[model samples]
Every structure is written in structure tokens, then in C-alpha cells.
Target: MSTTRLFNVYCDESCHLQHDGVPVMAWGAVYCQATETRAIAQAVRALKTQHGLSPAFEVKWTKVSPAKAAFYLALVDMFLADHRLRFRGLVVPDKGVLDHDRFDQSHDDWYYKMYYTMLRPIFCAPHRYRIYLDVKDTRGGPKTRKLHEVLANSLYDFDRKCIERVQQVRSHESELLPIADILIGALTYSNRGLASNSAKRAIVARLGERLGSTALTRTSTFATTKFNILLWQSREALG
Candidate 1:
């Protein structure tokens, strides 16, 4: 059996913020086994070649065009299924649930914090996890540094757990890392600004009920936790 100690996880997020009147929505975390990382890298290299993706292409190049973006989205799902890799995250911010002002004030940062929290529990046990977070902002400013600091601060306990490290990489150079990024982006576009209350509830419920049922560790602990997070969010929104 493949031990969990050698796992290297890559995570990305989309629609993570509620700047201005924009509704917050959709966050995703995708991962492959540490042992399988090399294989997954090879697969992505082949896909890039087949699709003529150049090394010099800008980050989020797949997102520049709709058709090409969708293709990569499908490709990501295919890779996950093929490798039996498990993932868990949420699509949030439909109308009446999340207001821009409220979200900003809460300082929750949804998936940014959620991914950190989720990874925390996994890294809790005596195993090592080297997590790679794909940089969402290339703008090179305070916002980007804040994100780096958040990730670093979140992993403060990992050094004691025999866990080696946490890293952030540019989305484009990260190859397979952007797959999760695009999935969340697609989710955001499909939900359309999270303006519909019914759609928001349905999306959150599905994430909790379905996506959370996936196998992450020897047990489906994290998936179950994700479901609970969805349910808790719903209750909090309702009250």
C-alpha cells in the first residue's frame, strides 16, 4: 500500500474573493499522491505537447480562451479519475448568502483559509505532506505577499510533524497545478457571480453531499469535514 507520508499536494482556487460588488464563489483543492506525482507530471507534459502549450505561455493562458479552458477543465477531471486521486472543496457565494461587504469584513477568505484548514487536519498525524500552492496573483504587490504569509503561517505546526515543507508556485509554471485553478474558475462562471440564492444552496449542498464523500486518507475524514463545513455555512447563513 502507498503510505500517506510521501504525499505532495498541489492546490489552487478560483473566485476566492469578494472585491467590490463581486460575489464570492467557488474554491477547489486537487491533489495527487506523492508517489504518483512524477507520473502525473509526465501526463501533463504530454497533454501540453499534444495541445501545443508552450513553456513560455503566460499563467492562466488556458483561461484566455473559452473553448481551450473547457478542454483543460475536462482534462483535469480525467486525470483525477484515471489516477483515482481524491479532491474536496466548495463553490460558494450565491445571492443572499454572501454579500461583498460581509465577506470582506468576516476575514474568512473562504477557500484560502479553508484549504489551509483542510490541509491542516491531514498533516496532523505523523505523516509528511509537501503542499504546493499555485500562485493566484502575479500582480506582485501586498496582496500576493499576504497570501504567501497566510500559507506560511498556516503551516507553522508542520515543521514539528516531520512534514517537510509548503511551497507556492506560479500557476503557469506549475503545470498540473492549474487544473484545480481552472475547475474553480469554471465553477465560478457556471454559477454566474453567485447571484442566485437557489443555485447557491444547491451548489453548496452538492459539494457537501457529493464531493465530500471522496476518499482522501485511509478514511474519508477530510471529505466528511468538508461536508460539515458546507452544512455549517448553510446554517450560519440562515441564522
Candidate 2:
């Protein structure tokens, strides 16, 4: 009998376009046991109601503002305080430096590779995972299918048992996806060296304080399961 544990991974990305005018790109996911998702989502809705926002109100990084700074901070607090939740983020400090031609790959190819790198650490034997990515564009369907194939092939899970599913979903539909948005937003903002939005800056500072770190731009130790971050550097940058 297989006593495999099920986990749901909600993924989000920030400034991922090759020429988005933003140098830093980040990908993040917030995952929890499959059984806990319903409860966690309910809790999030309850927080929204307590904060005087409509239950249907979408929690988003772009929605973070001075008026709702307190609510956003509370959201961060809630996420960190919850033992069942964990985060993993991968940051690319400068996408402009990437040489896809030299690597003999397209940007889309590298994009999938980055997703795999961001998610590889979360997979373990005997544990099944269902990945949910926020729909980015019209290509969402194809991207999801390709990503599923890539992840499964990389893990040698050809039967797709360990990597159960990879699907595209609207961020507004899932309570957890917004959490990933904010986390990824903070990483990209910090790495881009932006401070124009005080509200966003406050949230970033709160994350640092909660994690006992002065800066979010730095990478966290790989073993830091609670809120792991990887500042990815390309070979050229490494050299």
C-alpha cells in the first residue's frame, strides 16, 4: 500500500518577460498538504472579511497600497505563522545577461528550465504533488502541458505518479496563489532595487523582520524549508 502524501503547489512569477523593463525576474510557490488547502483557504477568506474586504476581493501584489498596508502585513504574518505552509522562490537578478543563442535554447526553453529548478527541491520520493500555475497569457494551456512533461521527464516519473498534475488556473480563483504573488513580487522588487512604493517596501521589510533577515535579496540556505529563496546566477554571472 502506498501511503503517499499529497501536496498542492500554487505558483506565481514576477517580471518574467525577457524585456519587461524590469531586470529582475522571480518565481515563487506556496505549497501545503492537500488536506490543509481547504482550511487554509477558508482562513484566508476569514482574514479578508475581518479586514473589511469582500470575500471575493482578490489579494494581489499590485493591490498592495498605503490604505491596505496593515491588511497586507497581516497576510504576511498569517502566512509565516502557519506551520503547514512553505515557500520557495528563485530569483534571476539580470535576465538581460542570458545568452540563449549560445546555450542553443530559446527563452521559452530556459523559462521551463527555471521553473523546474524552482520546483525541483520540493519533490521527494513517495510524495505526490499537483502544481497550479497562475495563467499568464493565451499560451497557458500549452505551457502547462509542456511544463508537466518537462518536470515529469526530469524526475523520471514517466507514469506521472510522483508529479501528478501541472495545470493553469486563474490567480483569482485560488486563495493561495495571491500569497505566491506577493512573495515573488517582494523578491523581484528588492532585487530590482526599487523603493518607490512605500507600501510595497513596508511589506518587504516585514518579510525580512519575520524571517530575521535584514535583506530579502540574499539567498536563504537550501535547507531553510519555512521560506526558502534561491538567488540564481547564470554561468557568466558566476564567472
Candidate 3:
């Protein structure tokens, strides 16, 4: 660790492909001071052990089921109760409406712009940051490097002192990335009107209740720190 204060940011996204057919594409991130990462992960492992899961067992939104609903709920509560952790999310309500071709931009280009936009509110300048993204594909290595370059250039972090590193790590290796998955999944699922899973609905309701909102689709209240959501609208949608 560096001598200066550092923040660790973990990010994950759902249904990001241009042709995924999913109506909503979402990105969520959780960040905290670098010193809290180990402690938070250890606490999460402890919670898993309490649920009779092996400490090494990975927690993921895909694994949320009626049988494991209690465990997932507890994890959600844990995240909300922890003041050290902060979450920021962005949702494209309808990916099909995006017109990257008309804008003379590639999907990758727009994706990076959205990524930067989602992260802008949470970033604290004059402090170092280390960002970890869930590995989506082996082919994204170049994209990951480009993300670092783009973010650094935009922030004017020439020596990369402000944004130290941005890299992809397997979700199973991270405790926070899975939380991002679960949270973003809930937002996307609700906004898509997907009511197929009762367990998911219950979790979403509980989360909304906790945030004093009936739905997680809108922007979060400014007073809220644990969960801040942004519902992205296309230029056409605005028009």
C-alpha cells in the first residue's frame, strides 16, 4: 500500500452487450477506503460461514434462490449498514434505443463514456484510487488498459497518481464485486418489470423500503450514501 490515503473501487455491470436483448443495461460500483477492504471481505466471509457456506464459496446474484434467500438478504443488510461502503449505479432503461451508429461512435466508445459518467460523482480527487472490474471476457484486456488511459487522460492524472490502477479480476476472487452484481441485478430486474422470481422481488422491496423509496429505478436521495442510483436517458428519450 502507498503511504497516501487510497480508495478501492469495485465495479460490475449486467447485460452490457449491444445485442443482449435485455431492455436495461446497468453498472454498479462499491468503494471504500483501501484500509477497509480486507476487513469487509473478512466480515463477508464470516457472514457466509454463519450461513453454513464455506468461507471460499462465492456469493453472486445468479446464485440468489429461495433456498439461499436469507443469506443474500443478510448480505444486502450488511452492505447497507456499513457506512464505510458507498455504492453508485447507472442504468440504461432501454439499450435498444441507443443509436451509437448515428452518433458516429462505437459501442465500446459509448460504454467508456457511460463508465466515466457513472464514476464521476464518487471519485475523490487528491487521493489515489485502485479500481477492480469483474473480468467479462479474455478479449477485454485491451479495453481495460484503454479504460485506464481514458480515465487518466480525462482526469488529467498524467502520472496516474490520482487513479493509480484499473484492472480486471475474477468475481470469485472478490467479495465486493458480487455485491455490485446483486444490487445492479435488482435494479435492472425491477426496471425491466421482471417478476418471475419471488425471491428477487422480495429483496428489491426490502432494499427500496430501506432506502425510503418504492422503486430503485429513480435517482437516490442526496442524503443517502449507501445506495445512489442514476437512471440514464438517451438524447432521444429526453427529447
Candidate 4:
């Protein structure tokens, strides 16, 4: 086994729930050490310098149109591969196959459910990993608070294992945002691979093959059944 270092993960997901038209997908990033974090950041900085790109993650993602977005995305993928980093992600059905809309009325709840399900597998390790999530909510907003609460609440603590921490950071300001944006954009492109002839089918196939049906089925079922029970019980109590 590779001796675990001080692993810090910078993770994000695309297609937060069942994709309305396509497949739902989530991605995880693992940095084995602080140096790796710096290296990743520096590589992104280099890209920004070479491209005259802005510093923020959101801008990097939203500023570019889809075709050019894939160009920068390929660079990010190359960087990840060169660094020997690890990535985990998932793609599953949306409403047609799994009814996330019926389960989560609020966007907050829906995203939180998806986020938790994505994090579930990584929590099994014994080592300490600091998780930094790119924040979607605006600054000084109730939505940020809700994100924090939802993240905290979703953590599963077995009697034997506890999470070191789960932090939702404001990526709007971080230089890392650009890097993360490219990563997430790539993931979005990946999950939507059902569309384009130029799409990376080999990678998508590998991900689909690794993910299998069990994780998707279990997570969807759990979210659906739990939400139904909660709704039913809430109505009962009100009555």
C-alpha cells in the first residue's frame, strides 16, 4: 500500500442531481500532500499566465464557451495525470430514471443529498483528509449557512470512524477556483459525453464500468425513500 501522506482533497460535483436531460455526475480530487497542492496550484497559475487568464475559478468556467472550454479542460486533465493524483466521480440517471425532483423540493436539499452521496465512499479511509469544497452560494448569504449545515449534517460517523472535517470554502476568491472550474467543466463535459462524437468515450466508459449499478441504485433509493418517509412523517405530525 502507498503510505498515506497528509491527504488534502479539493472536490466538486457536476449534474448535482439526476441530470434533467443527461446523466448526473460527481467528481473527487485527492492531493497526497501539501506540496502536491502547491504544485497543482502553481501549474494552474502557469496556465493562467500562459493564457492571460483571470485568477478566479468562476470566471475561468463561465467566461469561455463550450468548445474552447474543452481545450483548457484537456490541460487540467493532463496536469492531473502528470501529478499521479487520484480522481473519483459518478454519472447516473436524472428524473427519467431516478426522481430527484420528487425527493428534494429545495435546491439546497437536493445538492446536499448529492454532495453527501459523492463523499460517502471516500470517508472509509483511516487517514486524515481535509476536504475543501468549492462554494456555490454567494458570500454573506443564508445559502452559505445552509450549505455549511447540510455538509455538516450529511457526514456519516460510524462508531469506529469520524471525519476530520468537511469545509465549504468560498472559491469565488481563491486562485484554486480557476483550477477547480476547469476540473468541474471537464467533468460536466465528461458526463454529457452521450452527445458528441468527439467526446472522451474511453474515459467515460471506464468511469461507468468502475461505478457499476450498485452505488447509483443505492444512493438514489436511499435519497428517495428517506425523503418520502420524512415528508410522510412531517404531514402526519402536522395533522
CA lDDT of each candidate?
A: 0.51, 0.92, 0.88, 0.48
Indicate the residue-level lDDT of 22 in model 1: 52
Q: Residue 47 deviation, candidate 3, in Å? A: 0.4
Alpha-carbon lDDT of model 1: 0.51
129-225, model 3: which lDDT tens digit per residue?
Answer: 9999999887779988998998999898899998899999998899988888899989898888888887787889889888866448887666667
Task: List ranges where model 4 is wrong by over 4 Å.
Answer: 1-4, 17-30, 54-59, 66-74, 100-113, 138-162, 175-180, 193-239
| Ranking of all predicted structures according to lDDT, beginning with the best and ending with the worst | 2, 3, 1, 4
Better of 2 and 4 by lDDT: 2
Name the regions of candidate 1 deviating beyond 4 angstroms.
1-4, 55-70, 94-113, 118-124, 137-159, 193-235
Q: How displaced is residue 156 in candidate 3, in Å?
A: 1.1
RMSD per candidate (Å) reads: 7.0, 1.3, 2.2, 8.9
TM-score for model 4?
Answer: 0.56
**TM-scores, in order shown?**
0.62, 0.97, 0.95, 0.56
Per-residue error for 204 in candidate 4, Å, reads 9.1
lDDT of 2 by residue, 146-200 (tens): 9999999999999999999999889889999999999998888888888999999
Tell me how far the alpha carbon of residue 147 in candidate 4 is from the true structure, in angstroms, after superposition.
Answer: 8.1
Return the lDDT, model 4, position 230.
11
